[model samples]
Target: MFGGRALATLTRYRGGLGAAALAVAVVLLGLIEPTEYFALDQFFELRGARSPVAPIVIVSVDESSFVELNTQWPFPRAMHARLIDLIAAGRPRAIGIDLILDLPSARGERDDAALGEAVARAGNVVLAAAPADEQAGYTSLPFSYSRTTPNLPIDAVRKGAAGVGAINTPLDSDGRLRRMPRRQWTGVEWLPGFDVELHRVVTAAGLPAAPLPAVDPILINFSGPLRTFPWVSYFQVMNGTVEPTFFADKIVLVGPTSDQMHDVFATPFTRGRDQMPGVEIHANALQTYITGQPIREAPVWVSTVVAVAAALLAAALVVRLHPLRALAAVSLLWVIVTLFAYLVFVSGHAWMRGMAGTLGLVLGYGVTVVDHFVREQRERRRLAQFFSPEVLNEVVRHRREQSLSSSRRMVTVLFADIRGFTALSEKLAPEEVAEMLREYLTETTDVIFKHGGTVDKYIGDCVMALYNAPLQDPDHVLHAMQTALELQERTLKVSARWEQRLGTAIRSGIGINTGEAVVGTMGSRQRLEYTAIGDTINLGSRLEALTKEYGVAIVISEFTRRRLNADFLTRELGEVTVRGRTQPVKIYGVLPADLRKHPRAVIDVSATLTLSGAGESHPVATRDVSEGGMALAGVPEAWAVGTRVEVRCEGGQLPGPLAADAIVAWRRGDEAGITFVALDPESGPIVADYLSRRRSR
Candidate 1:
């Protein structure tokens, strides 16, 4: 019961305009770095990052070496031998020359010839062979002062040892290098980076390409720099003045290293302002191959789908839930993901888009939540805490719980209208009309509630209602009748006053029927309303509509008239055909007769009071009565067919119910029959007994 009402309340609130606006808000927000969703793509392009599954070294031509060797632009070939000797001294695997010899130098052919003679003597020397800008153009294998040099062609070098493809790296859109390139375009097929290429070179030399224990300068950590790496003068090396171990068996990259004059690259290890030579960049690349710390990028389609789905999820939540709840739920989602990601990021070396995802979630939720909540707040700007709250607070309580369902319990419904409101409104000013209708509705609606009825909705001058909801009223039928009669009486009093004030009477007719009705919120996703539909409800409306025909103020169906135990004067108006109803329904009309005047006399076998005679408060008790399956002794003889009643004891505060007419359908002896009646369902047995005892006293 509790769950159903809560659900119904939430459904009602959901059908309002706020939900639609919230849905739009959610769609427009929901991602942080939707653009950089494919991070792995960027990770794959870094050349230096992908190199070095094996050890590598670089022989750089530094500025100092340039000045000292006058080898300024083109250092001679002998200089490479000296440095190669020093590296070879380490007994390393292989050597690679990142230095491009595509262009001839100013040193002349003499220098190149001598360099070739020396290179022929050397067993392990590698030089760079790169593609020319023009396919038809070819200068030399290794430029050394001429169009050609002492270096062998790439094909020859591949024969002499394992020559590797050393291709240039391209930058990403942002100009920030963050990824590693695995392979580059070869003349025919894609080929590996410098590091992988070096692995082939080393293993070809009968040495394994497996990772080795080498003294790394930056692997574990980096704080500051040493005076410098082993950098000998280029000319000094050419002149054979440097150590021979440098070229012994090391994997060396011979590349330019001048601060203002060499092909250099950015690296994670670059200090202050000094750039690492391209040779060292290759070295880093090789080391990266050894570690294999690859960052995976999501597929483009996956990112697009994820982003779009995230938006849809937000929309779903918005339309399905209240703005406040959806906001909290979204916040919880981010927190959970962030916590999960934090754990993963710390434990796993996986760097899968942290900041971007965060930005997406934060921005998405922030903008969406703010938009949703703010709009809701604006719509509820006149938000009041139970302003003129109804008597049956079940709706309010259900609203608090935020459920979305409807129950199939029975409820009594009532429909009421002013007997002549249409003509009255037509005669008055709009403002005056509004004021009059508002005043009457306010009072009449309150009366329905006072009897524990839910005012379903007000249609012009008519009010449709239900009973036994929110807080279940056991005597819903009884209350409906009471509410109807009460409203009729209040209207008479009010009408008389209005007549004196405005020289016109405002008569209202109330119609109430007690039966099961389907009451709930019903509508579209864009809009909805709280009301009911059923034949019983139709009958109730029909009864109210019949008031004009009957020339009586209050009308009710047999279903309702049979449940009251009060002294209300009602006449069975017989059958009446109502619109949309196939058969005529039995109905009744309530006359504004004073219960205190006749005191509901049950004419005994003793005396009879004239219809116009004075009366008293005492209910003439019948010794016996019978109605349907019910019979009672010492039952109030005043009991009429629809009289409201209570079970009473001598001096026990009437323990059961208020005075009912006992609904004497038939009378026999001292035993009179009384139909079971509930005057007020919300009103406990105490109020019933109190009324019965007081009336008897």
Candidate 2:
């Protein structure tokens, strides 16, 4: 039992659970490193260009330099020595050589000596080194640290340079250089990157060191596409065409930019054939540190939390809203997430993947919509058992607008039962009884559904139905009465067939009442039933029982009688206090034309009536007239259900002026039923003659 209850509760909140599940899935997918990297690259492309904080210049060994010097693949070390001496004379903060110089110069020992002497004269140069692939090392940190054998510059040149650091440009899976290590861990020592070593050289020259990123692989904040930094050709610098003063007070980065040299790699800002040179990439990295603004990645936990939260929120909202409105809401959320991510990337230099969250919103919406469709289809199947196809369509189409939650509504309750069914069932075989009941119930249900009534439930031989509930009906009372009358007519045919089979007839008693009642699906979560409960429904059931006492096929309360037009003939059965009720209820038996004893003459006459009890008078008209009683139309009140009233009729083919004193019998709407207590002797003959004339006509 407990498990059943728990299952029901979970079903009730399945939308939320589905959303949470989607969130978890999205978060897990977002944690993938490749996805994060891809998002980071997109953010870089969208952010476009930004100005670098450090004043840095690139000295490029371009195709023009190669042509101008007519030098082979490896330029003579004396040539580099001349360029270094000129840049050092300008008093630059630091000079970084991006080329690997781990081998002796092919131009001879003296050529290597010349480059070593020039690096000693400079006193503030950082040479690039590499990590040997065969020697791998390990560390215990959150991010991976590069561990390998050290590849250092030739000792003759390395001994003279201020620092020697690894030049490692790690590419994402897509083969794009976007990040670099702050430092590499060799077995014996930690070697900083080329840019980090340059920063050290600058600080060693008495400049304050900028703060470095704490993460091992620092995300390089590219300034822009290729050659964003100021560039001068090495050939121009060597031949005195470019002044050495241009390098003063700046960090100089010198590396090959010629396509022939093949020192270029793809980057976020560079696409297809437009790749950034290796030296320019190092310049951007150095500027990233010098500006103290490396792109910081948001914590994994934080991104996961945001994506999940967004998905769950989407689920909660879409589950309750219309499909079109939910789609619009999801689209708006996507825009907001994208804009927020972009702002953080551009302004704060922080990478927070928004694609996962936005994708979560989309998926959440889709799943909830699918779930809603399935639930609605299930509900449609359930409702089909209670409502006609037309009514069921209306209910399902406007379900969101008219929810089936329990609420108070003015409705007409109907109860019908086969008279003496218990005794009749005992006398028949079980199979016979089942067949008999099935045919009887099916016919009666068809009658109820014909008038748009909701079949609430069946209790043994009795069926309870409701009108003006789950859907609105302005003429619910009339519909219920019509259904009851038709059911009696159809039962006669059923009784004939059953009487032939069992030598006993079957008759059904129907009762209808209209008033305010609580109506909707009600019961425990495990088993819910759409039904109604209140005094009105109880009174309807009581009246159905009273039909046997009155020997009538159908009975209705005063509440229902008042709503009918003069077309329906009814006989008042006086007031009786039903079981469980202190107040007496007035009921009437609906009679067909053949059963009415005293037929009322249909007449439309203007008249005036005075209520002696209330001491009030009002203009009235006659709906019909009989010798015993008359229905007074336009009488606002019932005059306390027995108060004596004087009615006067004048003119309008009434023979002559007639007056009578009558006792109020019943009242409904603007009409009142009254029986004549006495008629003035002079007017008695006149009313009789007038009614006779109307009947003859």
* Alpha-carbon RMSD, candidate 1: 31.0
Per-residue lDDT of candidate 2, residues 603-686 (tens digit): 666788998556688988888777667777787643544356898888778778878877565565676777676789988788
User: What is the total number of backbone clashes in candidate 2?
Assistant: 0
Residues 1-697 of candidate 1: C-alpha lDDT, one tens digit per residue: 7667656544443332233333334434433333342332232222123223434445557787777666556555445544555555555566666665444434665544444444444445555544322333445544423232223233322444345454354444433233445545444555455555665666667754445323211121111122123444555555667555655555666677776764654433343565555555555555544454333333434434444444445544554577677768767876776566444533443444443433334444445555556555563444444354353355445444533345556778888888677788777788877877787898888898798888888899899888887568898887777787677557656655665667556767777877776666666645677777788877778778777766556777777767866566566767877888887778876654333222221222221111112333332333311111133444434443333244332223334333332222223344433433323443345443344444431
**Whole-model Cα lDDT per candidate?**
0.53, 0.80
Task: Provide the global lDDT of candidate 1 against the true structure.
Answer: 0.53
What TM-score does structure 1 among the candidates reach? 0.40
Model 1: runs farther than 4 Å from truth? 1-54, 81-90, 104-126, 129-161, 186-192, 205-242, 246-250, 268-272, 298-349, 378-697
